[model samples]
Target chain A: MNIIISNTAGTPIYEQIKEQIKAAIFRGELKEGELLPSIRRLARDLRISVITTMRAYNDLEQEGFVVNMQGKGCYVQSQNADLLREHKLREVEKHLHASVVAARLCELSDDELLNMLKYFMNEEDEYE
Target chain B: MNNILELNGVFKSYKTFALEDITFALPRGFVMGFIGPNGAGKTTTIKLILNMLQRNAGTIKVFGKDNIFYEQEIKEKIGVVMDNTFYVDEWSLKDIERTLKPFYKRWDSGKYNSFLSDFRLDVNKKVKEISRGMKMKLMIAIALSHEADLLILDEPTSGLDAVARNELMEILSEFIEDENKGVLFSTHVTPDLEKIADYITVINNGRILYSGIKDDLLEKYVIIRGGLDVLDDEFKTKIIGCREHNVGFDGLIDSSVLPLLPKNIITERSNLDEIIVRFNNWRENK
Candidate 1:
């Protein structure tokens, strides 16, 4: 219900849902063993396709972020904090790699790239 | 992945208009833009889906259940926003919400209130006292609060300003962010669908002319402009619509046959509006 989506974001809809749920779990917004909304309920609430929500749930389950009980519905699963941290770090690395490639393409100097990153990090910190 | 709603070999008749062999599906999580010229059975198709009017023939299924057998269950999961507001004129936003809350088992008052605030709607304002845009926002708020899996909207942008329309699109885009929700947006405004619609089902003269992805619809057809010198018998047959000009002729060409054109003609990408207009015009003459 608190979800936001970007129409122009390169991320696919399912990935967006998956990443948001993961972030929510990581932030403890969704506590371990907490019950998540049913796929039908979430789809209706979000006005999204049930399949898209289902894919997100399935992906989350696969990632050990949630568990689906037969006929009972899905729930946030207990996670290894270390593993989650590693996963998050890997994602950041990939993003940084892409950013560096883009920065290189734009012919940004090391100082310029560092300044831009610092500015963005500071802006993001303010929001949180 | 299954059809949330489908009509097979469906037919409906009015005194002057009819829907013939109408078959289409709204797959789960996919938005199907139900498009057509005015009075071209777009509303009729929606009516058939809701069973507001009985179909003359064929079957309809919602959530893989026969429509007739699961009408109430289906209705409970479906959120409908028609072009016209059906609420009582004297009813306030709160009054409407109060009236509808008891009908949906999953109705969330908190969510409803939040939506009203987000949409900047006043709960005490009478339905008739609100502007058309505000009324639309109210309807959307109600629709979102009901926890319905499918949202069916008919001409939601018809009378709205660009900003309001963009707001509505943003809301819908967010709604579908979960991917479990599907939207059937019926509109004459092709440009809006150009931005958000995943699949398009276009009807004209009680028949489906095109039904598929927006990209495929754009890719499968093209607009070609050139002089009479560039025209030929083979070229004419492939045209969907053509218009004469002082200097030349411009027309729609099936992209599949683009190679058939002589080397000098200009072919450009066509959008939903151009395709719909050309198809309707061609049908009119035929």
Candidate 2:
């Protein structure tokens, strides 16, 4: 519900919408069966094309994050054990992609980057 | 009902100006903003759609029917608001209502009264006596009361203050809730469209520069700024609307080229105004 969209983002608007909805589900911010704004309402609020919003919702449904009900609207899907695991792994994959890009940009060696990551992981464990 | 309005390869000519192969579509349940610089033929296109001016070539379709063939049928479903008042100057708000009510088959008196009250228009005030903003509100009230499927407005917000403009936009967003309705509004105010329009068609010098999803158009271009030292032939050749100042040179470039640019260059998503201005510069420079 605390969605914020940036007009200037490099990602297309529909992709942004799908990502946010997925994030909300993964973070448990959106409960199972919680109703989402109808496609037209969301499009109106965001001042975007209804077609774009429909695409986002369709993608979310395909990814098993939401379900669209005839005449009722879209709702968050109840989390499945396998789907949750896959979703978490996908999130990690995104960060891994970013990390790879950063490592390449900074010319970091594998050893140095692995050591840095391990050191940060230990630092976080100590705090916990 | 798939496309509320469609114009394909449409053309018109005058002694000094011509509209050439203009094409765009407004699907049902969306708002399309028609924008351009002055004398860009926005009004002419609106006139063509209204059948006031005849097109020399191509076709116009409204509600999936040929516009010229179904002129009267199409006109009945269209609610029009022009930049200038077309009502008699001496006619009161009630008088104007009385005159137009007989023309539409589905005119609703209750809905009409509600619109007048909602717009805070005085029934006794003559057309000439009202403020520009009030007059526009009157037009909008009348347009909505007829239960038209499409609203075609030309410069409907030209003179209104910020608050009035916002009110008008809010009303438009509400109007599209029916899903069977659509709006094609022409304006120089690109910012307003950015807030409510689903699609945008930008015209300049009687040519269509871009026409499609609003987000895609914004995504296609980027505005970049950097110190004048980096302004070289490579940058110069790629930029649109390039402007040099004492401190820096700034202009627009295709978003795809952003990754290839030097690191010192700052980039932001180009806005509608920036896009139009840069397009005009690029055309003139070419």
Q: List fnat per candidate, in order.
A: 0.03, 0.29
Candidate 2 Cα misplacement greater than 4 A, ranges: A1-16, A27-29, A46-49, A69-72, A92-123, B227-235
Lowest summed lDDT across 10 adjacent residues in model 1 chain B is found at B210-219
Chain B TM-score in each of the candidates: 0.97, 0.97
lDDT by residue for model 1 (B1-286), tens: 5877788889988788888999888877777888888988898888888988898999988889988888988888888888779999999888988898888888999999999999988889899999888878888888888888889998988999999988887788777765577889999998877656778899999998877766567668888998898777767777887887789888898888877677567767787888888898888777
Clashing pairs in 2: none
Off by over 4 Å in 1: A1-128
All DockQ scores? 0.05, 0.36
lDDT tens digits, residue span A11-52, model 2 = 777889998988888888999999999998887787666767
How do the residues A56-108 of candidate 1 rate in per-residue lDDT, one tens digit apiece?
Answer: 89999988889999889999988897978889799999999989977876778
